[model samples]
Target chain A: MAAVDHDRAAQVGAQPLDVKAIRSDFPILDVEVNGRRLVYLDSASSSQKPRQVLDAMTRYYETTHANVHRGVYAIAEEATRQFEEARAKLARLVNARSAREIVFTKNVTEAINLVAHSWGRRNLTAGDAVLLTEMEHHANLVPWLMLAEERGIELRYIRLTADGQLDLSDLDRLVDGVKLVGVTCMSNVLGTINPVAELAEAAHSAGALFLADAAQYVPHLATDIQQLGCDFLGFTGHKMLGPTGIGCLWAREDLLEEMPPFLGGGEMISDVRLDGFLPADVPWKFEAGTPPIAEAIGLGAAVDYLTGLGMDAVRRHEVELTSYALCKLAADHPDLVIYGPADPASRGGVISLALGDIHAHDLSQVLDTAGVCVRAGHHCAKPLMRHLGVTATARASFYVYNDESDVDALSEALAEARKFFG
Target chain B: MPGLEDLYREIILDHYRNPRNRGELECPPAHRYEGFNPLCGDEIVLYLDVRDEKVVDLKIAGQGCSISQSSASMMSSAVKGKTLDEARALLRAFKAMMSIHEARLDAEDRELGANGQGADGEEAPPMGDLEALQGVVKFPVRIKCATLAWNTLAQGLDGANGSAGPS
Candidate 1:
């Protein structure tokens, strides 16, 4: 599919998205919530799957349903081909060095856990520091914390500035002796995009590996893993218009070859002797049990759908939408406090805001009445939540399907919430 | 499918706006217990003063949604002067009310041969303003918020009784 026209986009910093056409692909978008049109602003949590993805999974099940890599039958071979084909599509999506570098896990949480268990256990020891940022989702932080507790490894964090961007001023000092640096490319709560390339450079200069938690990045922006220069990257499918139960971890092929297998099971083993077992090759070694075959096929279809929409266009639409939302909320509700970089260009579509003295849960409840779906609470970033001096924030995130009207709806709902609570 | 009015009753909002017994009590005389709704980061700290087998006084210290905050406020007012046995009875009644829909859900799931138990029958005691929170039953996700303070209070009472020995 051709990319969105860049010449027109350059003039306004964004191409106008075909939002009506995009909304038509998602059947759930047509459903009414609370007798109102569903204004889905929770894509940052998990994106709504399109008909393309759903139909792809249904088609695969109807014709190609069989266990992969084990059976020699025709249907089994066809299933294996489709499964591996999905891996190649995912690899192309992120511009990974090779398809072998992509290891399928349950979700981003499992992907991070794979690294913490395999690479972390082999390399980290007592007092060996693994640096991370404070704005990471619990998916990124907890795995390292668990490794730190078990292996006596020290964990360090890159601080967040008052405006919610990562404070990399102390990067040189913090990464001095770190063995690995794990950072999110985007803050799931604050919508602040971190300088991944620069952080990767600092980690490499300090003889440490860098891992990019791209759960929020890959779904919204055009991702080029080579440009990002991270040794390991993790992201989930569910948050990227794909099915749940599938995620990808793209590591350098050499690194995956060196790291031990994450889980011990049938598919991951080459031969299971009475005394010991030989692990399978890199990607397959990481995938132990029966994979989510349908989910993988659905994810491939999701990739095709996004590639057709063009990630640049997707990013542009969100940037424009985010800017509109910021201005609209600020002009309408002076009491609304938005967390993250003030400039919309410096962030993704996530907009976490707090109204005057109102709890996030209460605000979200009121918004639900208006059929505006926003996520409320810590947003899996409790430490960042503490740093912001707020217990929780009602977050309304945008995607390709969202537009200025959605922002207007959110503004109107906020007004209702204020009147209801005030 | 229930409306906002079902989840946020006027009485609940009033309790949230002007929370009764909102603060911390002295630790020496008060037994403290904390509860957390990990799902939403809602925390409730209960400071209970149980003396001579009665809830002599109590205070709440924490922040959360209206359901949790107001539920905690009403809970403080309800059990402030009640005997330990009476307070336990109220806790049982309140929990039963809150779990009514959850129990029905479990029953439905069980009919599909899922692993779930049916709701046990329990007589409900008279609950005054606390009844306003019955609306929370319609919103399953917020039920934990409504019950946070009560759970914390139960823990504090259990600790007090354990420390006081057969009180």
Candidate 2:
């Protein structure tokens, strides 16, 4: 597999990286949950920050706690440098051509909102459609919905195959009248990784702009915006073992220039007057207020931590862990109904399931009692729940810190929940 | 202290496995109200037939955890045949009991608390076998599960009375 992308592997991972040593870098994994050793399997929701990321954030707040690009003072200069350096680091992680393409925002939700308001509202009109899939997170779904309603644009949905793959057969039909396509690179609930490159090609062939929500995929695998061939991409820092308050929107430099500014505020402007004020270019036009400074620095450090471990290795580790978990779950707990594909390679590390005679919430509670923390809900993907023919499901997601032992613990706890409830 | 075994008592499991009033209500004099607990994805629809200001009949149907479904079954029996105001009182008493362990409703104020807010938005818990759900308050995540049925009941009354918006 490494030979398949030998050039990429040569640039990124010629030297073998020790993931166990990298796991040691994250101190939060050493804590206890309800008297049980912490097995943090909820990285799909939000990852645990490593020691370096935490220390970087704390060090910034302690020493360089000043406003960025202001005051003409040494402290402000240092803060601005730290902030821009973080942008540069994010650019490297996403394989962006320039740091100017990275617009710091609150989270992936805010980043998507910027595009919906600035790009979609202005370019889209009545009869124009925005093609999306059934697999999108609500954050990606609702903004387009609001924009479509406001702009009188049609919202078209691409369906999903029974095997949980994207129903790309009708992509051409769905994008016939579409102006833009907003899709998820990976479904958080189903854990299916969509082929972003091919989807972007389809979307472009239909003459539509594409925005890929990289929230779930960016955390586990390496991302190259250029290779993905999407005009815009959005992701949150929290899900990638960074601090919570920061995220990025990576748009093609030309596309950012073409779209108008989303919000108006102090820093986004080159100059302001009562008459005809002009907004700053590219990333600055989108970033409207005081950007999350220390958090961005932490995200930069988190990217450093991930890069040090090598994302391919991390991807391989999660594949092995989730595959082992799925087999153990089906083999031991015959009553458990694990949703999505049986093959680990077909999905990411997320495992959604239901215990016999027990609702997902009850299953979650039983797991929690044994200190096996997992998510129990519709996961903000209610449409997917309906598609799966169930009310809700319990999900356990794995990351670099996760191993076979953690899956073993979840397996034991799940059997216990079923027996106690059954 | 006895682990999940303490939470999933035999009676609770029995009620979950074979729920009472488990199907959707037929369209008849009954008005329906659906309540959702977004956190746990538990949902319940309470159907009510009100006549002469009394609950002539009641049934609940939904998919949820044992705490939610069992609590709904208990509510159907407790609120049936009770006056609308009396049913309201039961809900207030039950909610209070679940939220505050030691809260005891006074005979006279129970009706007042149910019809309107108590002090500081702290109305008494709804009354009935719903009180068995008091154990859910100990688990913050399950609190929504236990309240799914009661909230739906409040909504059904709101639809009947036309002021059920807040519930």
Candidate 3:
């Protein structure tokens, strides 16, 4: 599969993504679904892992499997070193100030929950507001909602514009008295890339902390905590070609030190007496139990993979593919109603669409027969779905391995679906 | 490996295209029940008018995929003037056709099982147009969509019967 166009790469001025080589790395991309080649477009839900990531985990378990942090044995110390190395890799990936700023979590959901439970409960009280956005995934929204329920705090949202971008017109009013403002760096469904740095500036000017939900952004874009100017950021491993059960929460060290521990268990406490226990230092205090050690190692490998193929190159490839898809879908299927920003430069690689009178589930079902995997339904953003005036949208999200051929296949399948339904 | 044709049979597509008993009935005499397939966000809103053990009329209003909407349409047409007992029998027959009971069977037994039997140990009533949805059983994720309307009807019937004093 000579998928990358070298001629076009020259025009872009960035090193072209060797999509053929990248696809070879992911074993599942070669799999056939329904006697057709699999076209995985559901990376936003969870990305397919590369052999490197899988091999890294397998190698860890086979050679250096042991409980981390507590054990003084040889393998255990090696395991601890590897785990901390993974943390350092993640810290470097996002350009955090120190490795101590990175806290390992089950996934992005657990990371946000940690903040809501530990930092939120301590800082927030009744009548205090936490501002969020309309396009937030439930992972970012639910934790704050739960906090609101428990502490009687108010929740406000930065509304979405007609074009699907965050409507910052009301930011001044919305962020007025809020203790913290949380927003997704990119929308999972709409593919809207938000202006995190600007929002972070607004949040700070209003004397509020800002948290960026980078579950979608970190994998597709070049990210920097300093550039984003966020107080806290959360992202998952699975969406970045890493194994599941591992995520990261990178918070400013000072803020982390001030907050109490989220989950009270081993590996998080300095000393446990019958009366009470003293919590450990910043990062470890938030990591409660024997962590997902091998998963962290795999995530480290994923970071290494992404870094080797520069993030800038990956972003350029996605933008180009997204532009092609948008044009192809529009030209071929005029009835197709696409959701999100019209410009490919303004969004990530996710494309959510609705065809005339066809429900998203039915569309997805038809796409499945052609071996194109897409996500259907509310996408766990029912509030955003309601805002879009739709029950659901079929979303096809691209990743590093996807190319123009996949988009062509998607268009062909969509045409088949329309004819079949008619 | 059932083909798309099996799941989207002509009869099912017909009902989906021209749904029967769509829209709401006035509520003073009608009982409303809603069913939701939270997995896919498919909603079924059913309005039932029951009088003297008979379902006089019913209407359905909701949004979903072909399986759900067509199933709801067929259900409305099938049970418009039937007795509550007859409607329940049809519901049981349709669910059996969908292999609802087989889902609960232990894995080993399920592999060897024939068609699911109704609770009464009697033969299931003939499932007329509802048989078109039999293909849904192969697509397990869509079973909820095919049964959403029937389940809502059951709820409406139960609520109507329960609200009316002992007959």
Best of the candidates, TM-score: 3
lDDT, candidate 3, A1-422, per-residue tens: 00123213423667889999999999998899999999999999999999999999999999999999978899999999999999999999999999999999999998999999999999999999999999999999999999888999999998988999888877899999899999998899999888888889999999999999999989988788987899999999999999999999999999999999998899999999999899999899998889999999999999999999988788888888999999999999999999999988778899999999899999999999999999999999999999999898999999999999999999999999999996
Mind giving the per-residue lDDT tens digits that candidate 1 earns over A257-336? 99999999989999998999999998999999999999998999999999898877888888788888999999999999
| Candidates arranged by DockQ, highest first | 3, 1, 2
True contacts kept of 3: 0.78
Compared with the true structure, all predictions reach lDDT values of 0.89, 0.80, 0.90
Give the better candidate number (2 or 3) by TM-score.
3
The full ranking of all candidates by TM-score, starting with the best, is 3, 1, 2
Q: Which stretches of candidate 1 lie over 4 Å from their true place?
A: A1-15, B101-124
lDDT of 3 by residue, B15-47 (tens): 999999999999979988899988788999999
RMSD of each: 4.2, 4.0, 3.9
Off by over 4 Å in 2: A1-19, B1-6, B100-128, B162-167
Best by lDDT: 3
Q: Give the TM-score of candidate 3.
A: 0.95
lDDT of 2 by residue, A132-190 (tens): 88878888989988986787888888888888888888777777767788889888898
